[model samples]
Target: MMLEVAIKHAFGGFSLDAGFTAPSGVTALFGRSGSGKTTIINAVAGLLTPDEGRIASRGTVMLDTHHRINLKPHRRRIGYIFQEGRLFPHLSVRQNLGYGAWFAPTPAGRQDASRVVEMLAIGDLLDRRPGALSGGEKQRVAIGRALLSAPELVLADEPLAALDEERKAEILPYFERLRDEISVPILYVSHSASEVARLATTVVALEAGRVVAKGTAAEILGDPAILPAGAREAGAVLTAHVKTHHPDGLTELEAGGIALFLPTVHAAPGSRLRIRIAAHDVMLSRERPEGLSALNILPGTVHSVRPGDGPGALVALDTPAGRVLARITRRSAQTLALSSGATAHAIIKTVSVAASDVGAAAAT
Candidate 1:
């Protein structure tokens, strides 16, 4: 499934003008609060029609100003998952999921409840009420509910914002399962950098109601300049597979020909994972340094250098593992005579790779 949006609307003092094309998989609508992220979602959902422009999904027009084709919210067939689960308070998990199927316009297209339950791991909660479940379990049930509706598109507005870090971690794997296993395209909204880095296949970045950037997660997240203001956590995401578990309490992962050692991972060998390497945690040198405490040293060539207004500069490097970014002082960059196409070695500490940043079972 694919979604195309191009619209402009005025709401009191805040005007929303945004556009982007989202292909199958998770397309993250990322921006700070009040960047019009929710506004665009509402437009696609047919709750708030745009003053002008068009919105379409899978070649079906949801809204068109010139043609006056505006589908009602229910007719749009777009499932919406709010920050809260929004499950009926009086209903059991099974009944709540059944409600999604009841409203589905096409009985043939309605997703099998058993399949969605297995995919989201909500089978155990099927007999319980939403109040009896944990935050993570509630979100999973909410996702299952949306999927059972046979939606062409699923819109999630900061679904993890209400959960604490632990609950967020617990629920994220289910989303990864949804992104990889499900056929429906998902429009996931989030302002969290780590969430975008770990979950998004494509990123649509908004700033003050405009699309500042839109591309694959690797392209958008790898460039610090495209990140939102105060987004100092800008980094590159590399695809790697678990290679082995050593007796030393560390797991070995391989990306391309590069090796990454991290604290013990629970996944079995050969499982694909996405590791996020923060630019601030990386240091680039003109040549490979010797006798360094850091265990990672990858040979690479300088791809680009972006000097910030402050004393820092962000540098991009093409490494064997993947594109790696480094944030260093302007003086350090100048001292090393760094420039585009220059040969350098990226220095990274294995310990700097956080266990929480490793995505499980994510497609490459």
Candidate 2:
């Protein structure tokens, strides 16, 4: 484990008692509003001292309430990126990046500024101030600044919450790049399922200040029962390679020998991508239907069925591409006799997959 956190704190009506271990890649603290996502990240960054418990990185303890040891925020050697860029207005982008480097204990330990600038593609904006940059550009610089600090861990608290859709699209790929190219582990907090699906390697799901589930991104997102956002946010991530592009503006992808067609993906042929298929967008069929307008279909066996308190039921299918989820009503389940070991076909419309749900696959 790269990061270990176990903390408990209370303020007013809400109480937080959460603990989890994060491995080398991006570990997302996922939940809805006021679910202790921010609180946990703050505790890890040494900004908020927990009433009890401890936090450590790479076996070095940053906080231990029992031992009366609580390092200050500056001494923790962690970089924090807020919802907004929070760059210094008086300084140019170059100076703002250098500010992070100043905190490094030794000059030799700092990241190469030119390499970081090129990786984030912020070299062009280095001469400008924060007031002149767009939301996405500012965030890129903020990430660059954090990288230059040479910290052991990075903490991002809903970094995209302040951006609109277009700006979010612009910033997400940079985070993907950060996750793949950077060696430092990240403790990212977010309530957005799409963002979590696109970026998280390990998921620590919180609900009302408790860790309800923790696992790989695929495991937590695919299992509807464990999803903090319920069935609406339930989905599975499929790793596919761009096989070809059609003249009709559809891109063909191959996943485990299964063919999937989607809207024209902005990627070159043979490029790997992660596609998030929402459970609500999928339909189950006992037999493969014909003359359907949907362009994507997969034949698989029913793995499990979880019926909610209402009329809806979530079904899991073992498909060639990967684990796929379908949200159907109890009536439909009974009508089709859906149960474990039953054969079914999963149908999906090509247009149902929004552009944001597809992202460049992180390096394994």
Q: What's every prediction's RMSD, in angstroms?
A: 1.7, 1.2
Candidate that would win on TM-score: 2
Return the lDDT, model 1, position 191.
Answer: 89
Each model's C-alpha lDDT? 0.88, 0.92
Indicate the residue-level lDDT of 199 in model 2: 94
Each candidate's number of clashing pairs is 0, 0
Model 2 has an lDDT value of 0.92
For candidate 2, list the clashing residue pairs, or say none.
none
What local lDDT score does residue 140 receive in model 2, on the 0 to 100 scale? 93
Strongest candidate by lDDT? 2
